[model samples]
Target: MKYLLDTNVCVDYLSGRYPAVTRRLQAAAPDDLRVSSVAVAELRYGAEKSVHKQRNHERLDVFLREVACVDFDRDAASAYGRIRAALEAKGAVVGPYDLQIAGHAVSLGLVLVTGNVREFRRAKRLKVENWRRG
Candidate 1:
């Protein structure tokens, strides 16, 4: 099964602060892992907003070459609208970025690997695992 990695999980892997995350990722076949367009944008946003000398951006570029970024297509948009509306009706609104990531994961039938479990739980039919826990 393909796994959709959320922004925080991507950050931790890149940061090398968690060997468990890295090991888990390494264990997966490269084709089984993917990052969403939303995550790619977030990574770029974080890199550009940082005061460092483009270190993160350079690393992300290299990383991008290794894994494909799933596009936020029509299916993802439909899922996003449904999820956002449901969450709003339930009074459990989440950030747009997180919603986009979750929507894409759900639409593509990918299990979402994220640290933001609380917020992701707001979306129905979205499978989430917190690699940060291990």
Candidate 2:
């Protein structure tokens, strides 16, 4: 199955904070993995604000080279609007970037790999998996 790596998952993988997440990523076929452009933006923002900005940026560069980055296009925008409206109607709110990543994943039909399962659960018809759990 195809998987979309969330920002948190990517952070854990890069920091080696979660061995299971790292292992799962290593074990998966390269073509089966993807990173949403929204997630990339989040990562870049984190890197830019880090104490070790240069080091973090270099690490992000290396990681980006290994995984494919998918753009959030018109279809993803439609998905985002639908997801946001549905969540608001239910009084369930997901973070702005998280919602964008969710929309990207849902638009492309990819399972979202994240550590924040409860937060992502707010999005309907979006499959979420926590690789940190092994």
CA lDDT, every prediction?
Answer: 0.90, 0.94
Best by lDDT: 2
Q: Give per-residue CA lDDT, model 2, range 21-111, as digits (tens).
A: 9999999999999999999999999999999999999999999999999999999999999999999999886788899999999999999
Please give each candidate's TM-score: 0.95, 0.98
Q: List the residue pairs that clash in candidate 2.
A: none
User: Who wins the TM-score comparison?
Assistant: 2
Model 2: lDDT equals 0.94
Off by over 4 Å in 1: none
Candidate 1 pairs with clashing backbones = none
Predicted candidate 1 versus true structure: per-residue lDDT over 80-103, tens digit per residue = 899999999999869998998889
